[model samples]
Target: MYRKKSKAFYERMLKKYPDVMSIPQMSKACDVSSKTGYKLVREGRIDSLKIGRNLFVPKEYLISYLLIRDENNVR
Candidate 1:
């Protein structure tokens, strides 16, 4: 399914690029709703930075999140 491929692609991109990503992009990459991404940021679950009205999650943070989730089979 699309989720599988998207997740894999994003994982690959995150590992290779190590760049910051917007909330929407992070949501799509993680296959979650933007609201959830925002909640993660707002709740301090996922660390992010604000820049000119946009929130950006660093690739390292995302990768760590994914790796932890994957390890626990939570995502």
Candidate 2:
């Protein structure tokens, strides 16, 4: 017999492997556009690192930022 996975399992997986994402991946996951993601970086609302002209967002920071914004709307 096959078993079904639970929402909690996916949540835990996301939390455990947040770093396994890119800007496009994040845009899709967060329901935002790539342009908006770039704007957020430029506005200093989110943390990012530059490697020659490429920008990388830390997964933990992204997750925490979204969670804080959702909880307190501080941004």
Tens digit of lDDT per residue, candidate 1, span 1-75? 213234565577666443888998888777789999999889987889999998999887887776666666665
Per-structure clash totals for the candidates: 0, 0
lDDT of 1 at 31: 77
Q: Candidate 2 residues 1-75, lDDT tens each?
A: 334444454456467445746666666666789998888878987788887778887776676666656556453
lDDT of 2 at 60: 69
For residue 37, give model 2's deviation from the true position in Å. Answer: 0.7
Q: In order, what lDDT does every prediction score?
A: 0.76, 0.68
Candidate 1 steric clashes:
0
